[model samples]
Target: MRITTKKLVLCALMTAIVFLITFTPFLQIPSPMTQGYYNIGDAAIMIAAILLGRKVGFIAGGIGSLLADVVTGYYIYAPATLIVKGIEGYIIGAIANKKNGVPSRLRQAVAVTAGGLEMVLGYFIYQATVIRMINPTLGMASIIADIPGNLIQGAISAVLALVFLTVLYRTNTVKNLLR
Candidate 1:
């Protein structure tokens, strides 16, 4: 794809927003399993995906989240975060962009749900396999324990993203951006 100034600027801005939100303490809930906190950075990821398309969303979400992980001393999770978040963003963008512009509410909901599932399951696998490499049993246990927290975080992020998307659509922010 040709890189235009607007796309470049928006990508950078979204990356910065994702990093800032991911790094913020107020929105973080400490996770004992991964030692990295759960955050609402996904809200920005969802927005980027819906507005920017898959490539931009993947880059913004992945690199932004990876930077946050590195800076926050969750170095071991950086790689996993990049992959998981990138996939999540890609999934959202792909589904949301199926129509001419932004998708309908039902489609958006489906996209978010699928993307959220990716986030939840991706992290769970990382925790289960990579983090607890020594004791697979303990890893399994930890995965089980983390289920509730991950579910809650995913649900909250999805709700916030959808609400924000709705408002943006109603205000023609999405339409204006597309044109």
Candidate 2:
């Protein structure tokens, strides 16, 4: 597909939106179990994917989350966040937009579920292996402690994204954007 100025602007806007949503002090809930914080930024990531497609989803989600990590001083997780969120965005967009017409509710649900699972599993693997190696003091048990928070974050984000999509799909502006 040919890139357009509008698409580029929208991608940039979405990236900023993701970053702002994640980095805002009020939006973050510090995780007692890990260095990470839970935010609704994943909702923005999913919305970007569903509205703009996989490439924007990947770029916005990865870079946006990476920026949030850096700003929040979670530098160690920046690289992992980039990869994990990027893949999450791509998975959602690819599955949700597989057909020419708008995706059905079931398709959207499946897409978000798969993406959320990926986020949870990706962070688990990263924390369990790389994070464990970096800080040997954190045992396997400690590393595993973050799973519930991540799962909850994903679930909440999925619901928010679905609700937002449902509302946005009804608007003429979003319909035009999709086309």
> Which prediction has the highest lDDT against the true structure?
2
In the range 32-138, model 2's lDDT, one tens digit per residue, is 66677889899999999988888999999999999999999989989999999999999999989945767889988998999999999999999898988888887
Off by over 4 Å in 2: none
Per-candidate Cα lDDT values, in order, are: 0.85, 0.90
Clashes of 2: 0
lDDT of 1 by residue, 39-62 (tens): 999989988988888887798889
Task: State the TM-score for model 1.
Answer: 0.92
Off by over 4 Å in 1: 134-138
Can you give the lDDT of residue 47 in candidate 1?
85
Instruction: Estimate the TM-score of every prediction.
Output: 0.92, 0.96
The Cα error of candidate 2 at residue 106, in Å, is 0.7
